[model samples]
Target: MEGVVVRRVIPSDNSCLFNAVGYVMEHNKDKAPELRQVIAAAVASDPTKYNEAFLGKRNEEYCSWIMDPEKWGGAIELSILSEYYGREIAAYDIQTTRCDLYGQEKKYNERVMLIYDGLHYDALAMTPVESAPEEFDQTIFPVDYKRSIGPAEELALNMAKDAHRKRSYTDTSNFTLRCGVCQIGVIGQKEAVEHAQATGHVNFQEYR
Candidate 1:
């Protein structure tokens, strides 16, 4: 696998981070108790402050565990708090350290890497934007139509209208939406809005 650039966890990175945590919990059943404790401690801390610090520092000391398989047992969990569409959202998750354990000739590390990979793939599938369509018409008006608003404002207005439509119609309420490529359930307008905010698509005009 190619090396992944594990960027600093800004507040906007929470959803992905949380998805990573869920991936670990679901797939890494054999993770060490001590390791789990460390992850839990990090999650239990103030997410806003911790995420800010993590992003601000962007240093090895702050992110070494995420890159070192031996230190945090190939996985590290963290939280990101971000504001999207004027709403605060939290995302947390455990990420596998990118290392070639088999190449390193460490049997234990190799096993851990396999387990981590399983979780990572599963979590990726579960991400809210994993299955989102890309070609949906987001423009509410025709190109030739006269408009007084910018693209961002138009998008917000469209989102509000879609929210109202979803809230009013039961059949539409059951529809699923995607953020990027991730599929998300639409329980109602509020949930849809939350999902949009969480996935950094707050001003997206696409109905689904």
Candidate 2:
């Protein structure tokens, strides 16, 4: 991750984010044209919003607090670009807001790990601490890092596995499809099963 630059996103950087959207579309060529247009609109309007919407669509709480900055302190939108597998990737465009946990502890570093834990998936680590020591301070807090996974299918499978593992005993056969095409599952009971049936996908097996 050396030479990797993490900077705040600005209106001027929209083009770069737009290119990232293009890269995503090109990578997931099987995605529907209408879905691509909707995504393009979101990306073109605001990369931060696009990122939030994407996460929201997946039902992730990562970006759900963007609307209320008061509850989560200030919000920051950032983009990370790096070279992987001989290609440059828009590693992440995360929107994070700080929250004061109910604890007397100070000067403690909080770490959060996001595991793909799916077939052909990748694992990512996020922390509230900045990677650069010089950038660490009281005013500046690293909320979260938005790491990119490969494709929609991989993302879906990962989500599905997580859903199943979380609720194996209760309604193990039901789940919600977060991403329409991705088919990311969220375990539920009868409601989840109905949702899956509505989506026309019934493959709910444990992650190997």
Give candidate 2 regions above 4 Å deviation: 1-38, 42-114, 117-208
**What's the lDDT for candidate 2?**
0.29
RMSD of each: 19.8, 18.1
Model 2 TM-score is 0.16
TM-scores, one per candidate: 0.20, 0.16
Query: Which tens-of-lDDT digit does each residue in 1-208 have in candidate 1?
Result: 1111121111222133333333223332233343434553454454655563644433333544343332222223421211111111111121212222121111111011111221121121111132333222121111222322134233333433443444432232344444444654355446766876577554322254
TM-score of 1: 0.20
Per-residue error at 122 for model 1, in Å?
5.9
Q: What are the lDDT scores of the predictions, listed in order?
A: 0.30, 0.29
Number of the top-ranking candidate, with TM-score as the measure: 1
lDDT of 2 by residue, 1-208 (tens): 2122122221222133333222232422122333323433434455555555554333234333332221111112211111111122222111111111211122222211111111111112211344743232111113223322223223333444554456322223343334344456555445445665678644443322
